[model samples]
Target: MPAHDPQATPADELSQARRLLNRVFGYDDFRHHQGEIISTLLAGGDALVLMPTGGGKSLCYQLPALLREGVGVVVSPLIALMQDQVDALRQLGLRAAFLNSTLDAETVHATEQALLRGELDLLYVAPERLLGERMLSLLERARIALFAIDEAHCVSQWGHDFRREYQQLSVLHQRFPAVPRIALTATADQRTRQEIIDQLQLQEAAVFVNSFDRPNIRYTISDAPNPRERLWRFLEQEHPRDAGIVYCLSRKKVESVAEWLTARGREALPYHAGLSDGLRRHHQQRFLREEGLIVVATIAFGMGIDKPDVRFVAHLNLPKSLEAYYQETGRAGRDGLPADAWLAYGLQDVITLRQMTQDTDATEDFKRSAHQKLEAMLGLCELTSCRRQALLAYFGETLEAPCGNCDNCLQPPQTWDATEAARKALSCVYRSGQRFGVNYVIELLTGKDDERIRRNGHHRLSTFGIGRELNAVEWRVLFRQLLAQGYLDTDLEGHGTLRLTARARLLLRGEIELHLRRLRRPERGARERRGRTVLALGEAEQALFEALRSRRRALAEAQGVPPYIIFHDSTLAEMAQRRPTSLGEMAGIPGIGETKLNRFGKAFIEVIREHPG
Candidate 1:
């Protein structure tokens, strides 16, 4: 793998890549469209790759960076992300370094010397650093292999993680027109894809649209009355002693949740913009380097997280859009084990999001576009079919059937006529002059004679007290589904006032059928009652797995790195199940690259021998 060479055929380059994969990365074959994507890059062609999170996107660029002639200049987004990537590369015996503000000038100069001397295979530079005049000059002096623009969705204004600096990355294409460039992102819809291409100037790049389905992740959404207790249920029932992320919408939520969990004896940390830089860094570092730790964070966390064994991603509120939800939950189950993407959303989440979108300082067109995006996410919560199928469908990919993993597909939601109920609710709104929000209609239907209802004489309406057959909680569910199903609309100008849309008139006229799902009661005792005691392996083998995990943790602690960095839980599970005795057998294990085998093989093998199952 040098700076320049004669043309290599596809078969030749692939053979070379397979050899490198086994020798360096420890995997035997490429996952999904990885082989084709890497081959395209090695042949000096550009690509726009849309692979799901944990779909081995890193290898698409990392392997090519090694096979190409010059050092691969990767324009990454964050220092933490670069550090984690470089750490993984170094563990694989690859020469990888990232230049960011964290490095002292002397260290930066030394890394520059390494690059100029042709001693590095992959160089990770933040986009800001790469666009600087001095860094551009440094690249001019060194042999270039190709460029990889990671987290490419950051370049899209409509993307959840939009960065002003990333918008300027088109300079890479302009400056290095001949070199092949690959832009990679975990989550991007059709519009975002086009935005990425136009923003990055990769018009001619071969597009690779891998399926967005993460089948191993169990998707669950509950409109729970007590979201905190519901989240506790998920954490206790599903993921104990596993690394996971809990995403909140605001900094205050992050802090309170973190504190609440901490008081309850969970190793939880708060991460948001409100925290000092040092405090945020410390919390992030702890979350990475430790296990069984949950980080209650705003959207500020999880961009650069490379931890592979995050077993669950829990959300206390609804995400802004489907793409944001997809990206956030993707941080879980990266090791390809069974993971859960659990959410607790309600009508308030919808109302809050709608109001937020309408109150944005952007123009009406921008606000309208934002509202549409928010609606897509709300639709997911209202889905009665398969969560995964609906999610994939949003990205223009169709799942042939309901994924057995999501909650809806497993225990299909029960739908009732709800036509009479929907009409009653709509009549309540219409008879009340349709000037109130969802809460008011729900209150009137539930026969709650509050002061406002009594003062406004709203309780005397024909629709009022007509819905007493349903409780307040149940009525709220019907109203939410009505709004989501387009029988009702929110007046953003009226501050979330509920109004009838055209579809509601049909229902009122008895010319339309309406059905709504009954809200499922949240589990109150899963976490405390069953804390993940079951194992994929048998009793004897399960003991060996624990021992192996203990040993990995010891080594990771000694090295001051995340335990997954040493050996992912999936890999350890395989090792425990297989009961490899010798180094040769260990080498055959998945995730055992040559460098890791050389460094940690004998120790793990010895442990297996000492605790033979």
Candidate 2:
């Protein structure tokens, strides 16, 4: 552990932090608000930090834990995340340990003893564990640096991923008022942010608001006529053999997707709340340690996962809210590299979500707020402008200029005059008695005469067969846009029936011009084009990169750790290109700090020296 000098100048503290940043985390500088957040906490002040997942949220707390005298108590929420973090910190030669439900009795006792002995620099525990009498008693005896509340959004009941244990975290301030506290999360909108400040009792904390934009993740939303096929197409085109997550809305769907991908020769696993604890841990561990393993899961899966090189995040169904969507997508491109965020949605997504929200047992106000978030997500999917701009705006940040990395920016969709189409669709809903769902109404318009349609004697209606110009898929897009744009609403009491609102009158009477993006289903066997690739190197350097990766895989397998824990792919790519021949030069490269230089530096240098490329 590095010693902190009480007589040290402020310059010395800053220099020490930079030295640790390079020596431990393998970075030369702090990213975004990390430096300021760390300094504020180290100065015995409280802080609320809103950084993106890949934006170095952990470093802000971890660096301070090293700079200050005592162990930084990080109140994490998940077991897998705690293990991933502790493993990474240990690899960096830091004294890090964790206490959670997964640990056995002996191990827990040993870890507690270490905390009291002041042998550990950083200690991670779940909120429930931290609030326990035993753990609190142990912490009380130790000289504490600060309390880092990771995933602080879990404290907000309004968030999609709220946890009851997180609300109890305020007791840390009540018990240890002199110790500084830092609450951190990667996902929180304006309201949820305020809710976190309130719930965590951090009213005096300085707020560090990092822009929520993940510039490396390219966003794409497709109409799902056949989501299974669409997902395959996305994989074959955008991310073949890449490590990613395929998000589903249900546990059953998660299982099926995992099975389907595994059968197709892809490394895949399923994770959800319905699975056994052992199975969940196994799948989660495999995802962290194994490269190119896809974890098909519901929202139950991610929130504190520290795997840095996840190449993509695909959504087979719409998430519950925009906040959820943002957090999930932010999981990709965490290595400061290019990645993809893909989704396939149709009319069913909107209806199913609306129905699910209506059926929820939460308060009416909570349901309404959740519905608004869903609407915001729908707007992002149907948006014609910059997706990044709208995504940031939801979190109370604005983009002065458009980002050119999203699908809309790359291949802009064509807008069509849907005024006549909107009138026909609205009239069909009215003439069909405004009681049927989207599919039933769409059938009458597209002229698919089902038994129910014929039984209701709706074939003779004037609105029937008027929507021949648009297919069922296209019509679904229109209706979904209408619902999203306030022209229609779902009657929750009537079992997901579609109803026209007063706003629908404008489109019905030609008072407003309706224009919608004409969605195009990709041609069969057509590949989706990707944006710029990450860590681009020459062909000769590519060979060296592969060799470095092969060696990294072997080292990781032997150590029972993730490959990125040794060194991220970005660092390897830099080594491949620069081809440093000596230890002195290797030490100067980014990500190769003194600890790593002493440990694996010689072996990597040997690889580079022998490679003929």
Candidate 3:
């Protein structure tokens, strides 16, 4: 086994890639743009891949690695991720092993020995360990196939998860210039993708950009009187007794929400960086293994989980970027099941996310990047168009129309001309020495001359009583929209005092137009429980599902593992969707077992022809 050897001919490599694709991954087809990436890698070229989260990225590298007749050294970022991927690959009868800090020295030595003996198909290593001199030497001694960087966005300084260790991965190209390299990321905007190419020195690398759209997850945003009550209502209505994640912006909030869900008799757990390592691992493991469990956490969870049945993703606060939101929500519906992406947001979420970014010690360029992303997220939150369209547009993609599944597309929001409202608000900020907070300015404009208002002499201003037409809540909403639209700025040092930006000045002088979306109450009709549609199944799958259902009913009659345990309605529906043409495909369905398949697979296939599509 050596690092450098004569490369295979292009025709041979292409035939090898195609053969491995059908033999290993069990796919008779290649997704859009997959063949081009495969050809680039097989031709001994580097590539940067920007695909959506569930866009089958693993196969792009897995096929190339398996075809090259040597070990593929994959640089993974997390121990848990490496372990999970290795376990799945081994289950598929491919030889895969991982070396990380979690293993003892003896295990590490044994794994290195296996690599040198050319006994493994793919080996996962963390960037921290892979960049070491000893590790490089060991790799040099082995038959190197291809070097793959998973989650390559971490190398970019502008990405959410910037790791200093990832910067060291550039040495791979310098050390093995002949070996093909592929950097794959699920979530990277234009800037981050460019940074990855520049930082990884993939100057000659080909780039593949896929469409950033997930049409299955329905997006919904709500303004609640009390967010907890709304969250409970949402959980009860849409995703009861199903696995989901609730994301908050703080650890305390995570704990509080988890406890609150528990008090409400939900099987909920909390995870955060503040928790002990043992407890975090325990909770995470349980959440993965069990059903009907909810894990409330900050953004510290759901990186490399491959669970196929997550039903929903709820956000108690706004995420900082559309990319972050897209990646987080993608955790749901990985199995292509219909799921919900719900959010309960207010002005405070925007303020908190912005303050967090502003206080970080990153460079000014990083800060500006963060701000632009935040603004994009805010735009998504407040947009009057289809939420799905707005989200896809941010990623330089387009949609035909409103998805008709989101809150906005279901119930059109009302809009009001706020030109006069904006003028009054901006005039009040200017008259109050640009130092008063929104609350005080609203009070003065609505003609409440309280002690502070009189002390500040805001009552004497001409704009003081001009805004009496709007109520307190309406006024607050106006200012929130103003803040989000960049017409106003909050002085961070003075308790977020309202100050006018250039946009506000333009509005004050009637040089700019202003329109605001009035928050619409969730329609009572929208709350109705829509019945789930079972897929159109062929004769065999339908019979199989019915037989499985009959067995499930019998089991529920006996020891009682619930009909869902035998097979969820979703699993039955998917049995109809895929029409599993073979026994292996049947096993790939979520809850089907060999016993079940052996007993009922033929019957299901027979009934599949009669099943509705």
Candidate 4:
């Protein structure tokens, strides 16, 4: 078999890839851009793919690696992700292995020997390991199919998850000039895309940009007070018994939130850079293997987690940039089911993020870029229109109509002309000597007779009692909106004191009319659990699904792998609904490839046969 099939027509090559897909992965059709990407690589051409999470980006390279003569080298970032991918491929009975720090010397040498003998269909390596001289030498002795750079956006300085090691991956191109290279990521704006191309030296690679819209995800952002309670309400209402991730901006918050949730009768774990590596791994493993587990974490937790049933991703604080927000939120609903991206941010989140960005030791240009990204994120949170439209537009995609899925679309927020309110708010900030935080300023505005106000002489100010019409909650909402809209800025040096911006000058001078979202009380009544029933199975089917899950869990525990490695929930749902009692019938299911049919088909068939319904 030739490493490069130069004479095969595009039609023939695609036909072969499709056959391999069905036989190995048990999928009948190609998703959005998988076929085009696979064909690009199969024809000995480089590709730069930008497909959304769960859009079948893996198949683009995985299928081609199997069809080609030599092993496909995949550059991955996370050890857990590589392990999961390899385990999944092995479950399908494919020749897959990973070389990472987790493996001992004996296993690493055996994996290298297998590669030299052309025994691996796919090999996943970290960028740091792949750039090493020893690994480069080993690859030179083996037949090469192609190179895949997963999470390719990490090479860009502008991206949220930038890794300096990824920038050195151009060495793959420099060394293996003949072997095709494919760089792929789920999130990257136009600037990051160009940077990836330049840094990875893939300017000539075919660029395939799929739609960044994850319609299954319903985005909701709230500035409600008592965010801990808001998060509890959200979890109780929607994801009471589902696996999810809750993100915090600080490691301390991660630990505290996890402890709080655990005390509240929910099993939550903490994950951050501060935790010991063993503990982090243990928490991550528990989150993956168990159902209805929530992992409260900082940005360190999720980057290439392959768990498919994450029903929600909640953020208790503001993320640094829109790219980070989009990337983090994209982790939910990777299985293409209805999921949620919920956020509970406050004025203090804004102040803290601004201070952190300013205090960073990065270059001024990078700081400016970070500020711009932060502003975009604030804009998305403050959007009264379709959030999906604005989010897609940030990635240079267009949604002509409202999605009707996001919170803004489902429960349209009413906007009020706040020209007078804005002028009074700005005046209050200025009249307070620009030295007090939101609480003090709001107290002064609402005519609260406090000793601190008297000592500060704010009681005699003209703006002290002007905001008496609105209550404290309403005023806080207005002030948060003011900060989000850039009409008010936080004094980092003054302990988050509110100060007016140039933008606020126009509003106070009567040059512009300001309209803001009216602060509505959090919805009252019995909350309905929406989008939780992913399978939507009948009672009998639900019982059978549980039985199937039990069997999968047993098998996974025996093998020391996550249950999804054996079979995803969707695959089991199909089995439960179809109740395929025979091995032949089970093979007709979507995820049961030839290898899996031969491996575990009879066990699942026995379960289906024993099911009462």
Candidate 5:
């Protein structure tokens, strides 16, 4: 650990931070608000940081802990990820250890003794264990530097990933009044942000709210009827042989998708709460240590995962809220590379989610909040305007113009006036008793004179054949839009029966206009487009990049750590392009810190030298 000077000026502290930043983390300068956040902690002040996932939130506390007097204690919610966190820090040559259930009694004792003797620079602890009496007493006896509360939004009851243990974290403030506390999270709306501040008792902390927009992620929402096929097309086109996550709404769907993808020749795994702990841990370890593997999971996975090179995140069903969506999608592109956030949803998703929300045994207010969040997510999917703009605005941020990277911006959708169509659809739902699901409703509208339709109703009804101007697919799209726009609602206890909301009266009376996005089939050759290139490497550089990656994989396997912990893909790309010949030149690269330059620099340099460029 670097020694801190008590008499150092603020500028001097900052300069030392910058030097350590290069020597330890291998970055040239501080990104966005990192320097200010670090300076606050160095001056013994509390902080509340809300930055995006890849926005370097860990550095804000980790760097300060290295420069401070004693060990920095990090309170994390995910116990499974603590080992990786400690391993990454240790790879940087920092004295870091974690105390969790995975550690045996002897290991725990050694780690605790290390803290007491002031021999550790940083220590990671789960919130549940940190709040225990033994750990609290142990901390009181040690010289503590600061406390970092990660995934701080979990403290909010209204947040998407709320953990009951987080609310108890306020004890940190009461116990260690002088130790500067920093609470950090990747996703937090205005409501969640306030709750975190309130629950964690960080009212006097310096709040640093960075922009919530992840511009590198291209958002795409498809309502195509064949979602599985669409997902395959997406994978085949954009992320072939890339590591990603596929989110489903149920454990059954998670397992099926994993099996289906595996049959289709992709290495996919299933992860959910239903699975045993040992199985979950095995899948997670394989995902971290291997390459191009996909994990099909529910919301149970991916809270504090530090894998940096995930290429995409796909959702087969609608998430409960935009907060959940943002957090899940932010998992991609953690290395500042281009990634995709894809969704394939339909009216069924809306119905299933609404029913799930209503079926929950929570208070009415909670149910209403969940419904509003679901509505917002639906609006995003049915939106004909810029998706990024509306998504940002939901989180209280504004994008001045359309982000050209999103589906809507790239290929603008055409809208048609569906006023009369909506009126006819609603009338069919009413005239047919409103006791049927979407398929039944659509069948009646498209003039399907099947036995069920004939037995239930007469073919002589006015709405029976009135919607012939639109095909079955078009009618499905219109019905989905109607439900999403609140002109129609589904029965809570029924089998997805359609019901008219009070807002539908005006449309029925022709008092207002209704315009909806025109449904169009995806282009046949769309999959031919190349995926986003992380670096503009020439042919020779590309070959050299592969060689460096092979070397990284070998080293990572030998040391039993993830390859990115050794050096991220971006770093290898830089090394391939620069072709550094000596230690000094290697140190000049972006991700080559002093520790790494001395540790693996020679091996990589030899690879660069021996490559046939």
Candidate 6:
């Protein structure tokens, strides 16, 4: 080993980070990868940071821009991101500006002049803006200190948000050979990571991969008959009167859902590309400014948004890929507070996602890549193990036990022998000439005498009536398991045909044993009963928690914001558990700070003492 540097210490590193934090945004500590990533950039090295949302990635670049001598050029993909960051920097008294298509020519010219005058510390520009020869020459003329790429995963073809303009970002190094570069993204798998590095030409960059684990988030996947009903129930019970985003797969679904909520007397809005830009901006602003505003949208929303108090994010359909799923779910619980990350999954979600993936006209490599991602997401949905552990493992991390937060961890499921069900489903698919959809095959297997079944004569097949032991719902569940287990494949070209794979043959021949888990169905009565019983808490603790929440609500009202904006539900739960008696003890809670302690410390102590232990 080389000789150690006796002069360097962890204290020195921390002190440097604290100073930078205070100087730039008036903070005192780093969140997630902000410290290491900033240090790497300041040392004149490139970095690849894979942090979750609410992990303070902007600070990684902002602090380095303040520490460096010249201006830091930030290449962002969204104009809204530029405006938000610029406004926030101005609030902090930092000289920052942006150049984008949204700006008028005069404003753009003024921004360039400020850059050349060395009056601005950081300048944000879109990738397309940076590609212009005029902008390139302006950058060359300015004293460049650093080059930062935000949302760098967009450079990869495998990324869900791939943009062709991102391919030109590599020119930054050739044009400004001495500027330190850093590529940042909240979500990227191993494949996308390599593509980002290659496309950005950061071969020699120091990699600072942070943990993708969001332990504060609780992941739950529910298999219900009516997904929409289940989603409404979940929202009403867990996160009533909170701001959230619900993602539907199509624009039509977005509109209908938003209208449905509106009819039900909820303050919800529809958002998608089909709407006018003015309408989209209006809905986006309402969601940000108003509490309990639900925005139902397609995947076009929620990129680089600074909303930290999003209490939940629901997916009405499966996302395009696991990376997309991760990135979208990351929009929740960004303040290191407890938040719910939920998905109402079913058989149709799998079919819809797979069909969408196959319908795209891409190279064979891209199709196979997408297929692998879908398989991973499918496994996540159908997993009988811990959801948090499975999610973390996909990102190259390990969790040895249940996280004690998710649904599965709270109420474990039972496994059964699925080998027979798998065989019957596969047999029905094969006997039906692999030409029918899941519903038809399911009816055939259950020996239903429906018109379509008799018209197709599927009831006369050898596999028909063999599966009469199970009901229609049971057969549907079995088919979903078969799809998740790879025993069957859906033919996307023929209106989502159910086809048996080779694995199905082995099951039929008794050469392979398939194991399936028994899924629990929440009946209306049972769900209603569960809903009536509020969150489980002791009498004293419940009182204290309620009191703390009341105080939180008062403070939030005083500030004209939502209660969650002050402290998340998870933080309240922690306070209830600790029953902190002093300011120091209260400040030691996860999200409580000195400012908040000064504001609400006495109230919290009074609440805790008013109840019996």
Worst 10 residues of 1 by lDDT: 525-534
Give the per-residue Cα lDDT of candidate 2 at 475: 84
Extract clashing residue pairs from model 1.
2-69, 3-69, 26-593, 236-527, 237-527
Model 3: how far is 549 from its true place, Å? 11
Better of 4 and 6 by TM-score: 4
- What lDDT does model 6 reach? 0.79
| Winner of 3 and 4 under TM-score | 4
lDDT of 5 by residue, 44-124 (tens): 999999999999999999999999999999999888888888898889998999999989999999999999999999999
**Which model is ahead, 2 or 5, in terms of lDDT?**
5
Put the candidates in lDDT order, highest first. 5, 4, 2, 1, 6, 3
Model 4 stretches astray by more than 4 angstroms: 1-6, 492-494
RMSD of each: 2.0, 1.8, 5.1, 1.6, 1.2, 5.5
Could you tally the backbone clashes for each prediction? 5, 0, 19, 0, 0, 0
For TM-score, the strongest prediction is 5
Top candidate (lDDT): 5
The C-alpha lDDT values of all candidates are 0.85, 0.86, 0.78, 0.89, 0.91, 0.79
- Give the lowest summed-lDDT range of ten residues in model 4: 1-10
lDDT of 6 at 476: 82
Relative to the true structure, candidate 3 reaches a TM of: 0.87
Assess candidate 6 and give its TM-score to the true structure. 0.85
Q: Taking the tens digit of each residue's C-alpha lDDT, what string does model 1 give over 39-157?
A: 99988899999998889988898888888888988888877667767877787888999999989999999999999999999999988888898988889889888899989999988
Model 2 spans with C-alpha error above 4 angstroms: 448-451, 523-533
Superposed Cα deviation of residue 259, candidate 1 (Å): 1.5
Estimate TM-scores for all models. Answer: 0.96, 0.97, 0.87, 0.97, 0.98, 0.85
State the lDDT of candidate 6 residue by residue for 220-329, as single tens digits: 88886788888777777777776789999999999999998778766789999999988887788677655678999898998877777787899988886778888999
User: What is the C-alpha lDDT profile of model 4 across 1-613, one tens digit per residue?
Assistant: 2244668799988988888788888889898989998988888899999999888888989888888779999999998678778989888888899999989999999999999999999999988899899999999999989999999989988778989999999999999999999999999998999999999999899999999999999999887789999899888888888999999988999989999999999999999999998899889989888888999999998998889889999999999988899889988988887899999998878888877777777999998999899999989988999999999999999999999999899999989998998889889888777777889888888999899889878889999888889999888888888988999988657388788899988888899998888764578874777633667888899889999999999989999888888888889999998999888788789888989889888888889889968
